[model samples]
Target: MRIRATVVAAVSGALALSALAAPAAQASDDAVSRADIAKVREAAHAASSSKAAFSARAAAYDEPYALNVTFSNFKIAKAVKVGTTNRVTAKVTYTLTHGTDVDITAFDFLTDPFLYKGSFAAPQNVLIGDDFGHCKSTSATKATCSGTIDIRPRDYELLNADAGTWKAGAWAIAFNGEDPGADDFDMGKVGYAEKGGLATTLVQRYSKLTVNASPEPVKKGKTITVTGKLTRANWEAFRYAGYTNQSVKLQFRKKNSNTYTTIKTVKTNSTGNLKTTVKASVDGYYRYNFEGTTTTPAVKAAGDFVDVK
Candidate 1:
C-alpha cells in the first residue's frame, strides 16, 4: 500500500555535497581509502629504527606520528537513518589545528573525518567520504575542514550489524608530494595522525507510515473506518517490510482545530497492518503516529481529511 515517507532529520555543521562523488582522477578510490588508515597505522608501529624507510609493500613501518596536529569541534547528527535503496549522505565538519611548520593546504596533504563500528586501533569496519575533505586555513596554524559521509545500504561496506551506534574518527596524512602508491617509497617522507571515539551517533533503519480514513461523506454518528500500515527498511531483504506488533496511535483533529487528539491506540497486525473503526463526529482529519524505537526514527502519517455530512 502507498504511504507517506517518514521525514529524515539529520543535522550537521553543514550539509554534505550533492551528487555521488566519482572515483578520484589521481588514484583509485579504493586504493587510497580502503586501506590507507590501517596501512598508515601499520607502518607507524611496525617499522624498526634500523630501516631507512618502509617500501611499497607497506610492511615494517616507521613514520613519525603527527603529534603536532589535533582535531576538535566535530559536528554530526544525533541519528542517521537509511533506507534500503537510497544513498544517504551527511555533512561532517571538524576543526584541525597543527604546528606552524605544517602546510595543511598542500594539494596532496590529506586530513578527513570518518566513522567506525569497532576498535579504533583495529576497526572491523570504517566509512570514509567518497571524496577527500576540503580544508581552508582559518589561521596560520588552524583550519576548518568539511567532508561528506556517504552511506549506501546496498554496498559491501555496510553489514546488518553495522546499524547501531558508530564512533567518530579523524585521520591525517602528510604525503609531502610523495607517491604513497609507488612500488617503493621512503616512509620517512610521510607523516600521519589519527584519533577515534570523538563522539557517537546512531545509524538506524528508515521508517514509513501511512494512514487513511474512509466513508468520506459519511453521516454524522456513522461508523468511520481507519486503516494504515507501519513498515521499516529491511537491509537484509532490501525492501520495506511490515513492522508488526507495534503500538501506533490513531489521532484526530476537528476540521477547524490545529491540534490532533488521540482517538485510540492500536497495534499493527502480523503484516504490519492497522485497522479500527470509530463513530463519525464532525468534519476533521485522521492520522497515525509511531513514537519510534532505538533502531528506527519516529514518524507520522499525513492526516487524511474526511468530510462528515
Candidate 2:
C-alpha cells in the first residue's frame, strides 16, 4: 500500500523527536516533552532528509531486523480468476529473539511480485495489526497473527499490466519496552521477514462460450446443426479473442428438467468455431460449456431453446 505524504510526514516528525531523547529506562517513562513539539519544524526537516537517504539505499540494504523475525504457517489461495472477487488468508507466527525483551507495537503483512525489483511500487498491503485484531502474543518472544485480504475488481486492475508469481512477507515495528515514547523508535527497530516457498501465481485471462442449434421446429429424426464459438481475454490487445483448438462440451437440458446432460464433446477449430450435428428428439435447450484452462476461467453460455414439431 502506498503511504500518503501527509501521514508519512506526521509519523516522521513524531519519530524524529523521539530519536533525540534519551533511551527510557522503562516504557512508561517514554513521554515526549513540550520542548519536543517546539522542535517539530526541525524534526520534519530531518525526517525528510532521512527518507531521501533511505529511498536511495533501500534496495541494497538487507534489513537486519528480519534475521530475528520468523514467519510460518503462511497460506493463501493458489489461483484466482480475473475480474472476480477473492479473499486470501495467511497465518503468521513470529518470534522476536533479537533482544531479550522486545515489545512489538505495529506490523503489516505484504505481498510483492518479483517484478518489483526492489522498487517501492507493486507491494500490496495485506493485513495490518496493532494491539487490536489479527495479532496476539503468546509469549514475550512469540506472537501469532492471521487475517484475510479481500481482492476486489479494482484491485485486479493491478494485474492488468503484469501477471506472475508473488511473494508474501511481514513488516513489523517493535519497541524495546512497553509504552515507549516516540524517540524510542527508529528504522532499525523495524523488521521484514519473507517466507520462502510461499508464492502464488496470477493468470490474466477470462473465457466466453456460446451455442446455437439451427432448424428449429423441424420434423422428428431430422438432423440439427449446432454451432458456437469460444473466446478469451487477450491481455495484449485488451480485447476478447478466439481461443482455438480447445475442447468444449455440447450439453442439452430437456424443457422440464433442471439438469443439463452432455450430448457430445467437440474441439474448437482454427478460429475457435464449434460445429456439430445431433438428431432432433424432444423439446430441449442447448448450450456450450468450456472447462477452462490454467490461464482462463470456466464459462457456460446461456441455453438456446429449440422447438420440436
Candidate 3:
C-alpha cells in the first residue's frame, strides 16, 4: 500500500521584469502573483491525480497483481573462458500474495545491440517461473520456496538483444506474469522466501577491473605510493570486456583504527595499472585496498605495517 523510496523533485524558478513606468498595456499590470502560482500548482496536482486514475485503471487490468521479488547472497560465478557458458545463481526464493493462480515469469533484455568478434550480436534471456498452478493465501502466516537459478550464455545474448542489460548483479531481477490481484502476506516471515529472489540477467556484467595498493609501509608525515595492476581478462561470456586505462582510488586505514582513509585517485595504464602517492602524518601501521567507482569492484589487498623511524 505504501512504498518508501526517493522521489526526485524538479525545481523551476521564473523571474519577470517590468519596465515602461506604468505599463503601456493593461497586460503589463497583470503579473502573476504567489497565490496565483499556488492555484496553478493545485491544478497541476489535480491533473496529475486524474492521469494517475487512468493509469490505475489500466494497471487494474494489466497488472492485476503486484509481486515484489528480493534477493540475498546473490552472486555471479567467476568468469569462464570465452565461448563457454558463464553461469550465476540467484539462490532465488519467492512468495505469492493474493493472486489468481497466475504463472509468473521474469527476465532481462538488452537496451542496445553490441558488436562481438566482428559481428553484431544479441544477448540471451533468463526466465524465472514456477509451474505450480494458481496460488492462494495460506491460512498460515506465510508461504515459502527456495532454489538456485542458473544463467547461461544464450540467456545473456537474449537479454542484450532486449536491452535489459542494465539488470546485472543481485540488484536487477524483475518480475513477469499477471499480478496475482489482491492478497497480502509477509514473504520473509517464512523460511523459504526469507532469502528473496533475483532476476536471472544479473549474472554477467563485469568489464575493465583491476586492484591496487599504496604506501607499502606508511609512517607519520611520510608520503605513500599506491599502485594497481590490470589482470586484463575479458569476461566476454559474461558480457564483459577486458580493458585497461581504468580510474581508481587507493583506500588506507591506520592499523587498529576503526575507519579507512582515502589516499589518492588515479587511472590505470593502457595495460590496466594505476599508481599514486600520499603523505601520512599519523604514526601506525596502515591497511590498503583498491577503491571502486560505480563500474568497478571493491577489492582489499594484504596489509603492510610501517613504524615511524
Candidate 4:
C-alpha cells in the first residue's frame, strides 16, 4: 500500500536502530540500499582515509572491524495474521550481548530486529520497523531491547506472496561520535554487526466464514439444508475471496446448550461454498467451523438458528 515496508524509518529516542536517516536512497529494496551504502562507504574512505558521510545503508555492509556483539533470546509473535486494508504491528524483543568495551547506553548506539522470507543473504521479501529498538542494560555487556514491526496492507501490492514462514534477523550500528545525518562522518570509526536466521515466525492471511440453514421451523422427520462459504483476506485486491478445497466442519448446538458438537465434515467446493443436509431431530443452532492451517487462521461462523417441530 504505502511504499514497501523495506524503506525503514529512523527510530525514535535518538537510539532507534533507525537513528540514521540522512540522504536515504529510496531504492526498490534492501539489497540495493546495501550496495549503495557500501559504494558510498568506499568513496568516502578514498576521499578521506578515516571519515565518510553518514548513510543508513552501512548497517548491512561488512566493515574491516566489527564490534564484539551477539544477539540472544530473539522473540516475535509466532503468528502474524493480517487482512487487506488494515494495519498490523508485531512487537519484537531480544538480548544484545556485546563486549564491555561497547557502550550501548550511548544514544548514538542503536539496534534493530527484522523479518524476511527466503534466503537471508538476499531475502525475497523483508519486514522492518520504522523505529529502532529501545534498550535497557541488564548487565555490564548485556542489554534487553524491544521494537516493533509494522505492516499496513492496502491496494494492489505484492503481499499475498509473502505469506508463510519468515525468518528473523537483526543488525546494530554504533555511530561512535559521528552523527548519521552529519556531513563530516567517519565510517572507519563506526561499529557494525549483523546476523540472519536467528529465529523463525509465521505470517498468515486473515480468514472469514459464514453459515445459513433453511426451514427455521420444520417437522422433526423433515430434512434441512445447511450452507456456508469460506473466504480469506486478499491483500492484492484489498477484498475477501473464497478459500477453496478447505475442510470445514458442520457443528450444532441444542437451543439450550452451551457447547457445539461437530456433526459432519465437508470440503469447500470450487468456489469455497459449503452445502450439506442433516435430519431435523430437535431444536438447535447450526454453524460452520474451519480448523486453520499454516497459511490461514481457523474461523467459525455465527450459529444459524433452526426451530424444529
lDDT of 1 at 32: 53
Q: Write model 2 residue lDDT over 159-188, tens digit each, in one string.
A: 333334444443333322222235544434
Q: What tens digits encode model 3's per-residue C-alpha lDDT throughout 75-173?
A: 332221222244433443433332332222212100101011110111122222111112123434233333333334433222223322222221111
Backbone clashes in each candidate structure, one number apiece? 1, 2, 37, 3
Model 3 lDDT-worst window of ten: 13-22
RMSD per model, one decimal: 8.3, 10.6, 20.9, 7.4
lDDT by residue for model 4 (10-118), tens: 1111112222222243322222233233333333333333445323344333332365679989999889998987678899999899998899877566677877777
lDDT on C-alpha atoms for all candidate structures: 0.71, 0.49, 0.31, 0.71
Candidate 1 lDDT tens digits, 195-305: 777788888889999999998989999999999999988877888999989999999999889999998999999999999999998999999999988777889999999
Off by over 4 Å in 1: 1-38, 45-64, 121-124
Predicted structure 1, TM vs. truth? 0.80
Candidate 1's displacement at residue 160, Å, is 3.6
Which is better, 1 or 2, measured by TM-score?
A: 1
lDDT (Cα, 0-100) at 137 in candidate 1: 91
